[model samples]
Target: MPADPESGQGPAAADPAQQQQQQQQQQQQQQHADGRPAADKPIKRYRRTELEEEEAKKKLLLLEEEGDEQYEEYVPRKKRREADEAVLMRLQGLAGPAAPEGDDDTGSEIDDEDEEQQQQQPASKAARPASVPQQRGKESLLVQTARAKKEAPPESATDKVLAEEADMMRHITQKQALRAAKELATDTVYTRSMSTGWKPPAEARGWSARKAQALREQFHISVAGDNVPPPLPSFALMKLPPPIASLLQQKGIKRPTPIQIQGIPAALAGRDIIGISFTGSGKTLVYSLPLICIAVQDEMMMPLEGGEGPLGLIVCPSRELANQTVEVITQYTDALKAGGFPELRVMLCIGGIDMRAQMDMLKRGVHIVVATPGRLKDLLTKRRMNLDICRYLALDEADRMVDLGFEEEMREILSFFKSQRQTLMFSATMPAKIKTFAESALVDPIEVNVGRAGAANLDVIQEVEYVKEEDKLAYLLDCLQKTAPPVLVFAENKRDVDAIHEALLLQGVDVVAVHGDRDQLERLEAIRDFKGGKADVLVASDVASKGLDFPGVQHVINYDMPEEIENYVHRIGRTGRSGKTGIATTFINSRQCSESILLDLKHLLKEAKQRVPQFLTALHDPLEEMEALAALSGIKGCAYCGGLGHRIADCPKLRSESKAQERSKKDYFGSGGFGGEM
Candidate 1:
């Protein structure tokens, strides 16, 4: 073995005798070949006192005497019985009392053992394992800390009531709920008890024991079904659960309306229905109840996988009506939810808003859909909604919906529903076309007519005045002065509505106008302002006639007669609702008093037991008068000025007016119909 240059004294130091001498010198110096002292090797410093070292030694010795290996034995040494008593006594001194005798002795012993071990260990032994007794002590301390806290007491009665009221307030918006609350609080006559001694007509009252005979002769409630349920005498007697009954009572609906009394039972029996009731006859609830009941019943079945399709579909003719129906359904849905029913989802689908938002809402499951025909069809076409699971369907204002060019849309929507559904058609007037549609649509429906089909409200004091077209605005202004507002005035067209609205506004009469031409937001605001009493009069076209239920309407003025005779019934229906009396004045002109209009008005008035005007009665037969007028005017004529002798091209009055306007323009411009002063 030769030493290399890199190893300075390696070969020489390998000698046994010489290596011994060098190691002894290295030990004396306590130095390595690198000149770093061996004594300076990393020595950790600890600040433990002498007493802690002695205690740790004693613990080790105790472990050895007990025949426990420190590495293998995980369990801690038990504390002496006297030491445990001393620890308990100390705890009692701090707590001011000893623990109850019923306390677990094992838990106390474990805790004492844990405390003694913790006190015995030195702080330097940071790598020591946690003992069973230490863990037990921690868990017990946690339990004691938890037991020290107390639960909050139940809310007081007053506080509970207030919280419930707050929840109710949050359930519906303040504006909407307050409006309905005001209407109910101020007007109790409409919903008063039926037991009040004020008897209805013998024909209207069907309380006799002759079951089948009474349904037909008395009350005029006709049903053509195998097993139709009889009309319930009151809301409380219906098959409604107790919660619904209480909710109805809370809303102050003690007695059922004639329509509700007749329609609810038939609908709940799962039979189709054709309910012809006036507006504000509580028709919304008549169909709403059965639909809700059906939905609740179906809820017991297995839920639909892709979320629930509409269980009930209510088709409204107009967006306003659709939204109103949604509001009514939402109120009841909230009541059902409060009564521990499943969260029933409801959605309103209409146009003139975000279609994407509506689609999103529909894509998420909805239990009920209150929709206008156009919007509903749009969603169906887009594949964003389905109605195959629908078991209940209601067509509100079916007549008007059919007439509003929505028949195709409505038919398409109806086709989407299953054949097993219960169909309900609610119309103010049942025209032949409506009857035909219902016959094909419903399955042996029960036809319930509250009054005559085309009859006006008997509570409405209707009057007719022969006012010319030019004088209609003034006559309406006078009527506004004579009657109590808020008044709803109907015109034939949007132009007429705008003209009347402008006139009223110029005269400083707070007024609003609503028509098909206005955007949906504008229409909604106009209605809100009118309903909130910010506007004294609402000037609108026939759009407001059909399904809108405007409470507190003191008068309805027909500024322009509706083209269809059935519309006259619906227009007058706006007032005199819910047994409250109102006035309806029709401003008729000679042109409006044509035989058909006059005859229909007379018939409607007479059917409603109102005094028909003699002038209207005296009008000649419309068909005969049309023939006579045609014979008198042999040539094509201008209907605007009633030019019987010539066409509008040859009419003297029209030509003269046009020539005068041209001459005035020429004179204002001096010569060339332009300002020629300079």
Candidate 2:
């Protein structure tokens, strides 16, 4: 109780009477004009107007009457009701009309009660009145609340909007389903009615193996399939359409070739076929006639519209083959059009040509498309063409396509087709890979082989000569002179073709050359001149080797022996066409020519009954000879590359190719590369 120097008047301030008097004085000082305690009031950051002050006073009185717990819950409930009312008003506006009378009576009553409470409150008290009357015949508020608790609540505006959206989506889905059903019906009807009216004859249906073998021997034709069709004797017996028959007659085709004998009927009967005959043996007609017939049938059934067509698709390996195929198809199509049949449209899609033109042709609707694999794949990738309606797919010169590394591209192109199609694979040889691909891609294909696959044309007199590497250019002219004008000289590479072409040109010979390096126009002109007799000698690489028809070509001179025996077969096949005998002269040497090819050539010459050179005869190995004998007996050889000289394990070409691939892989993806160490 002692007053220290740090405290002033501490003892007097501690007295109870003094403290009470000071508190009273302080309370009096804090009082406002309305006699409310200032300590209970909230601090105002900004001055309020008269209306805000009155509203504040009303809220304070309501809170005091209801207690803190009821005030907190009731105020939030009131706000929620107001917000829902605003949303309902917006939803009604979007719905384009007012709601029905009794649909929302509960909401309307609650809104009315709120409005009356706000209006009837006196300036002194903000508490709601307890005696507010309910609408006539309506349930009391407490009873309505109890009923709502027992039943599902009315749908909110958001829920109604979601329901309407779902209903609209269901209607759209139903419409789409109906449209799809109609399209499916149309497809079914079209498929049921479509037919080519071709059936196997009685003689073709059943025949003993001995009789079949004898017939095959007579015609030198080998066939393999279930229910193989017999060979037709004459063109008239084929029972082709009148126009086609007449056209064949006009073209002086009185009899069906060995390939056409069985291929045509099987194709017309809607069976997939693997046609393997020597080159220039009227193989084009086998696929062309069927393609035109199918296209004409499709056109007659329903005319093609824009962005719809190409019932037939022929994929070739090279541009020349594709163009040649298109020409063959066009000829028959023209014949059909002249004979009062539906006019068929044939398109040639190849590389080195403007794509816009091809696109325009597609826009106009084509009935048949003959295209090389590369260009065809490019168009398909760009979505400029589709195979939706195509029913006939012909892989012409399929061996050549596979050799040119187009097997993967062909598979990709096949994937573009959405449905089953009659696939025809025509080649001079059926390698094992091609056979496997055919088995996987085609459906029970008929294999029609005219004589042995990869056999040289017997009609052509094959003459092999040994010439030094330096002496080949000089000896080429003498070989060209063995036959009359219109001879084809083949080289293995473009450089040799150019060398031979230039030598012939400088020697005052009428010769033109073509290779992969030439432009499209140059190649076209070269072929035109050669075929039209404007040029006496046409020098070319293997580009002209496959599937090109040269009328009256009496001689084929190989400036250089091709690496592959299959190419050799195709090269000499340019002559001896259409049953006309011709001569083939091949130059060989120790260097720049593999012994395996020479062995294959010797076997081919011996098979064709042509004289073989002593060098080729001596170049053969005993193992190769054994394999060749087995190939002759079992018809099995290097089925991978169609080589008769070796099996797959001893294939020099495969070995070299594998080594090259390994080297390339090492170069690109060895250590410190993308693939890391191999």
Candidate 3:
């Protein structure tokens, strides 16, 4: 009843009698109290428009004739339809006698027909019903919808997209739909396909335990941390830019990854180290910093000693990866070139063009030489590429080096290295075989391993799709036809490899085929073609899974499921690399699969702790995720996000790639590492 302090006013325009009562209330606040200074009258603030709107709403509700009780109905008035003839009149006036009166209706009919046909066809895929007549308003919308629903491809946009949405929901797994979306809507298109069989040799049934042991030895890890590493030493103290340091800090990479931490220090100390880690781990930096450090050598420049071939020698397994590493190394080199290395020269000796040019470049005198095992071996044997002056020797991807059957070559290359030179062997896995190879190649060296490629990297999704045995080819065709981007199709035998390659070619699809049956030059050609984007698909055997790198491939299809699970690991490893987004689809059916295969498959899924996606069909029902997680127990960290998560969705770098001019993030598909036969 008293005027509020914030607003010294009572309700305005009250009745004269009420105004008198209000005056009494005001007087009470000044000691003529009637109820303890009259509960400080609650403030009432309202704008003129708001007050009028409330009043108008109340009046409308009060005037409602039909409503029984007082209720303000939320009446959103329907918009009036525009006159259809008005557009016709305007068009007729413009065109005069040239446009007939009914021309507009005919045009509308044609447009409706096109829309109906488009709606009927599934997204990204070509209209499969060659004979189905295009029906617009000929049938009831309900009837046509029902028929089209049944007729459309199961992997099409209709099934994946909710009808309620204005736009179709996308299935990243549908290649055809994604391509269509790209063309039709000018949106980034993503396509996917599923294949069941064509297993890699690592997952082959014929391989004996000795072979598994041999494969294991290819990447022999001597150092398994007795305890979790003392939270890695941070590189924050190195004083880098915010963006670069942010990634380093996020990974808790204060000092460096294990490989970088160990290898960098040893190489800086001018000692050799045999470093091993997973593919995504930072191995380039491990050897690079030390190389740069050695090159600078307290002289604030990449001092070039004329006639010195190179100060550092980097031998990689694949040309693509070698090229990629050179790019990263060069990026850092350029930054430090001003103060540390002004005229640092890096010579690349990898396959895909001319050896003469490479030799010419090498002879020009460079500070660093990045090369592949075979090309370097060839050059070394030819005495064109020399390491006599090279003090630091780094074997990037050592497992792939051995796996690609370059151990003998590596041994010979190492014999040329002086015992005083530092030798660093980096790989995904380090078994006894790698150790023996290293023992023969390297001297006493510090051992460092961040992790091995044991189970699937969480970001690299691994799943199995069961198709009927007869449907395998159709499934593969559907996958290739439906999935966009490049695919690496793995086949068990050379015959199936050729069959699929020929079939894809007949479909007017660009494909490259590689297998053991093919000669070295031919395989190299196939790989070169695929890497160049001249070939869209590659049908290959286990050899492709070795050190072969083609970074653009977004999908890996098992045309025939690899009987041995490790082969599956190697096959998919082709798609998902360096923390890029990739998918692996394995075709599993009754004929190809058995209890043991499913068990191994299930075991992998269990170890990954990922639920079997609904797209994946199998004889046995998938286990509960919590149970799998409990069984697997191990927490998998995303290489990109480091979130202890799985899949591309959770990977920060991958997510950024899709959103951030990422197509060139690093080809998941890369140039071939091995030579194919003619």
Candidate 4:
């Protein structure tokens, strides 16, 4: 009041020097009052400085307050009393739980972290005061359930007030959230029990090794009385005649694959065999070895077997596969020296090629005929060929052959095989229908489920990305360019396939579409190009998923998720095959999200660590527990192995022997063998 501070007259008048200082102070004050910071003071030029700082402080305070509130909210109340009661019971160690015996959490297999969350969740139901509950006639409710009769404290004079004032505030905790989620999961599963009748997989009966053994010795050999077949015979010892074995050796056939070893003997024995060999598991060798051996052996054994040529037959689902079969036969048999091994004759009859040429070949009395079901049916219908003389029949792609809608042709082909004929059906995937085909085609066949059939190979670096549908093509382009060399990109539709083909063509990215819409010749050519390494990337629909098997392919990209999970297995098998490692990348877009697929993917991950990508984290496990329970409800494992509870191979005895060898080696070395206390 004496003098305005900005004016500075009062403080400045005492001394000239003091007045000078005062004047400086007044000058700064005046500057600040003018809505500008003092010249000496730092200023915030950004407009949000004060407001943002204030808001930040406010938010911090509010968060602390909210946390307190959340703590208080955990107090058990009527609304959450039941949940609270359950938690209280669990906390008091009163769940009446047994020990972790055999992972028997069929009702509620909540994880450990989830159980803690449930134990911490607020009670939703609790006893109320007489004013609120007298109308319901309150029973004598125990005050503290955490204690026994001898230990429990009596109800306090004002226990309600103390309980209400229990140093807490209410807010949602992680435990509460987890418990709620667990509750939702349990509710979903409990409401819908997951029990269903077991129906063994189709073709399961025919593809078994035992059945094959039974078929072989029972029909082919004269073990009429008590002569039972021996345990799993070697592939080298399969049904092929001595001449055929000598021929295969000339072709450098060294070690036999499990399927080949197990399947060949059974097939040669004229057993109906459903062979569930994985891709590149030498399933072809199993069927082909038997076919050639039986054809030549039968031809040689029965001089009257000389109707025309080899009597064995092979039917593949696709021309590409049929072509491969024919090529393999040609290569395997090219070394034959004998009345030409009697197995020497090999022919190809598939769709799109000239019928007259096939007819001409058939007239030559070919012994081993590899044909697509459709084309073979055509030849049979037109009387261009007849299977009446065939002794061995093999359905190479029995499952896919059926899936491709060749039921009628398959039946017709089966009709030509007499009861004495040996039938073998092999598939990458064995759906139920394959079993039906086996029962019809096979006579007491054996079933086999190859290893990791539902799993993407561990050696394959499987990757997935979430992306928009519109940008998928661009992403694909980027991936192709980045991946380089060999990459297979799948497309959802034929239009998409064509578009990608054209786009890739523009970029000089070697790509070709292999789909049903394409002319049969084009499809075959596309697959051939991929196999021959003429095409770097194969862009196609489901056709490339199964039919085309290119062992040289280093990469497989799922530009679109396969319609079913089984297809995913087969598609990825195209890569990481023939004991060579490969990579597969599946792009997950919103469009392809479905409960069934999501659940399948989850189980796929849980069972097969070999297929788990190094980059996969908990975040990538996008399946919702509730959705999984809902999807898995009313489903049972296939009856053969109790619904695939364990891997089909990896015999315990063999594993023991391998372990014994490893242990012996360790003992000989006198060092810790495998980083363990051995």
> Which candidate number maximizes lDDT?
2
* Residues 1-678 of candidate 3: C-alpha lDDT, one tens digit per residue: 775646646655434788788897777668834454335645565443344557767767677755646665433211011133234334445321122345222323332334643663473124223332222346888998899989986753322222211121122222222011223345432221111121222333355656533533443423432211111134542323344445445544554554554345345554446676654556678777667656655234444554556778888876656766787677656666544335567777776657776766665677788887778878877776666767677887675575556766766675565324666777655543344446433444456655544456555677577688677777887777545767889998888988888888888888888876676567767877888888888888876775455667788898877755445666777766655777778887766654444554665676677666443334343223223432332323222222222322333333443555334345444563223111
- Tens-digit per-residue lDDT, 211-292, candidate 2: 7668777887878878666666666556677998888888988888889887887788888788888877898899888778
Ten-residue region with minimum lDDT total, candidate 3? 76-85
What TM-score goes with each of the models? 0.60, 0.68, 0.48, 0.55
Summed over model 1, clashes come to 0
Q: What is the lDDT for 416 in model 3? A: 62
Runs with alpha carbons beyond 4 Å of true place in candidate 4: 1-253, 301-310, 337-343, 452-459, 481-484, 610-678
The residue-level lDDT of candidate 1 at 72 comes to: 40
Q: Kindly list the per-residue Cα lDDT of model 4 for residues 1-678, writing each as its tens digit.
A: 576766656755646997688788888777688666646567433322234446656766777877754422222222244455456556656552223344222334344533534564442123332223212324455743333655867765334323332221111011122111333345422221111121222443335656755644532322211222232444343334456566556655565655655455455554556776566666788777656655555556664233354377788777777887788778667656444544466778887887777666666667778887777777777766766667667777676765565766666665554324556677766644235434543344466544533445555666667778889888887777555577887776888888888988998877778777788877877777877889888887876666456777788888877646667777777787666788777877656655435445545655655444333333333233223322332212221111122111212222443466565553444455453336
* Tens digits of lDDT, candidate 1, 542-658: 888877878879899999766556677788888888788988888877775444456656656665677767677676543333343334433122222222222233334335545
User: Model 2, 490: alpha-carbon shift in Å?
Assistant: 0.9
- Weakest ten-residue segment in model 4 by summed lDDT: 170-179
Model 2 off-target regions past 4 Å?
Answer: 1-195, 201-214, 624-636, 664-678
lDDT of 4 at 584: 78
**Candidate-wise lDDT, in order:** 0.68, 0.74, 0.57, 0.57
